[model samples]
Target: MSSITSFNDSLMSHQNFVLIGIPGMQEKNSWVAFPLFVLYALTLLGNITILYAIKIDPSLHEPMYFFLCMLACSDLGLCISTMPTMLGVYWFDSGEIPFNACISQMFFIHILQAIESGILVAMAFDRFIAIRGPLRYRSLLSNSVIAKIGIAILSRGLCVCFPFPFLIKRLPFCRSNVLSHSYCLHQDAMKLACADTRVNVLYGLIAVMCTVLLDALVILVSYILILKTVLSIASRKECLKALNTCVAHISAILIFYVPMIGITVVHRYGKHLPPIVHMLMANIFVTVPPLLNPIVYSVKTQQIRQRICSILHLKRTRG
Candidate 1:
């Protein structure tokens, strides 16, 4: 009975420490929960709708749309894995997650993040084949090839994220458990470790550099090749159409990656910045891409916009 009581007391004390910074976490956070909630809800619904539409539409069964569906699905997973927990903590003051739950959140967040990175790389490759080798596009990126790429993406994501949770598990918690961010980010969580986290930090950084940064470099090369091919095309109309098709994808990639780089740089060097600034950058990195992806694709892709309108019309007719 004495040991149980002691354990309970220790748990309560840890909880108290974690809650201490909660009051200061987002004390001045603009109170935009309602808007953010609605936006996230729409993102979830919109992405799901896109995935379903592509799956069901016979005309949309090509490699490009197949990859778009995968992108939508990954974005949906990303938002679902991170946004709810973050919004709950930020808006409802329910930031007190158990240690295990926090670790789980960190794991899934990183998994989805890696998946997104891989999907972007796959999309860039898809565009490369379509533009540079148009005649062989269908034969090269067959259904089987796409399935193999999808499996590889999930596998790579799991492999990259495997070390993160394992490292977190080994860490001894001695300091305050209070996390400064709305969600349980790996680096932020590592700061609470009393153990030597040099290994964890090094492994995490290496995985990110290998996966995300390397993929970004490949994407840049693909775009450069694509630009050269486009410039060599004979007809101005074909060039404009090709460029316009790529514009939405380019915009989405920039919005997603630029803020991610900003967050990484700030986390590495701008530790002295105000907490609000850190929080704002984190929010931009997390929220903006999910919100902008569907919008950009819908505006750029006539098929997606048409399907959305058709779905809306069906709902209105039913109502």
Candidate 2:
């Protein structure tokens, strides 16, 4: 307790921090750069391709496609947010970040993450309306309505993440400011601060519950309802068609959440495991979603597939 108070008292002098990038790699840390750079590049290309397909295809201007565009945009934001610092650490061994920059990075990364979670919920809602209320879905999710939802999504993320940096800023990082990873995570940064971080931890927990977990629950319930609705339909072909449409989205959601949850569990409870397990989980949690999201959407979504193929000058043959 005294140590906490002493650390809080010394909050004003912190100027920068060191991030321990891929500490488990040690000698192999340099090799990790190759994969990181490849993921960064592939993610950029995939998301850019998705955005371009949406932009050029007027058929994709509807709410579903628009939400996809938003998802791609958010993925791009997530990628760009950490790319520089991550690369610096892996490639150049430059792990030091100024205090303000670290704060900025954390704010953007978390906000983008929050935005992605909200977008997934919104997308699930879209699928729900499409499957359960096909006749009304169009009218229910008009252009104005979709636009409002997008705005609300952005606002929710911004409001949720706004206080995190400020909360961390108040607590002086008196202990070594060296973070466990190449990224700036709220909990990671908080632990570096020697203050009584009970407030930060509680708020962080509340934030996760309100955002990611809530979104996941809603999605699960939505799918259950959708399945029930589809099963009740008499036409087998129609049921299959509806499920097919959902497959791509389900894959994308799983890709994002599985590793994210793994990392979260590892971060909180897997302290007993090797450090490399945590690092690898952390690496894939962020990288895999962006890397696979566009690819899944492009391959599994017929419209997107056709558009992408056309962009590559591939000719489609009529069967």
Candidate 3:
């Protein structure tokens, strides 16, 4: 027990970590920085524009737009979580992160990712309610009710991710402190611990089972039911129109979950895969969704698309 206490004490005494910044790719961060910077810029501009459009246009005052706004906020949070540190590593090779800051990043990243999943589920639920229970949709998911659902979504993510950083804290990281990704992630940090990590592994697995995995399964089931409801429509045109309405949400879900699944797969069974592959996959998991989410909605969502076009046209007229 004394040895265990000393090990825990020693781990707590350490307060620094090094982000290895993508093994063989760190040498080319300058070249990498340009694309990353551009993606970060697009992520910021795109999501912010969505929020701004939703804010200014009263036509977008529906439940769908409201959820899209929430989604935009989550995407923005995700971008802010890792952009600076990622740029620092790419532009200046500044990969040293304080232990606490790393933990903070890990916490927010997981929380935001979880929140994003929850939002997608809510969006799916909205579509479900709209299609399956169109007559009662408003009464079932009114403004006040939507607010409560939002709170529950955020609360669930907080409850699930709250223990992630603390779980890592209990482990003694006597192994190398170099992280392979541009950002701090739970798996990245846990992998560096030399001690027995079975408990951490179990907790992490349970968290995933309850959160992302469960969310994905719920999303899948929602879509299946959505498809069934759409199929019941008498007119084929109506069915097409209904499915078309879901294209943006489906895209958002795919962009968010597919890369995440890839990251998990790479971590679990890609031992023989190149280190660069894992790093690139992790970076994509962070960057792609934020970059693509707003674009998908802007292009696919009619009200937001029209508002954006009007804004651009007005800008052109002024210019």
Q: Rate the local accuracy (lDDT) of all candidates.
A: 0.80, 0.88, 0.90
Please give the ranking of all candidate structures by TM-score, highest first, separated by commas: 3, 2, 1
Model 2 gets an lDDT of 0.88
Per-residue lDDT of model 1, residues 74-122, tens digit only:
7887788778777776567666777777788789878888888888888
Ranking by lDDT: 3, 2, 1
Query: Which has the higher TM-score value, candidate number 2 or candidate number 3?
Result: 3
Off by over 4 Å in 3: 1-14
Q: Comparing 1 and 2 by lDDT, which wins? A: 2
Off by over 4 Å in 2: 1-13, 314-319
Q: What TM-score goes with each of the models?
A: 0.91, 0.93, 0.94
Native-referenced Cα lDDT, model 3: 0.90
User: What is the C-alpha lDDT profile of model 3 across 1-319, one tens digit per residue?
Assistant: 9999977776664577787666876787788888999999999999999998888988888899989989999999999999999999988899889988999999999999989999999999999988998889878888998899899989999999999888888877766678878889998898888778888789889988988889989989999999999999999999999999999999999999899999999999998999989888988999999999999998898889999999889899999
Instruction: For residues 139-172, write the lDDT of model 2, one tens digit per residue.
Output: 9999999999999999999888999989988986
User: How far off is residue 205 in model 1, in Å?
Assistant: 1.6
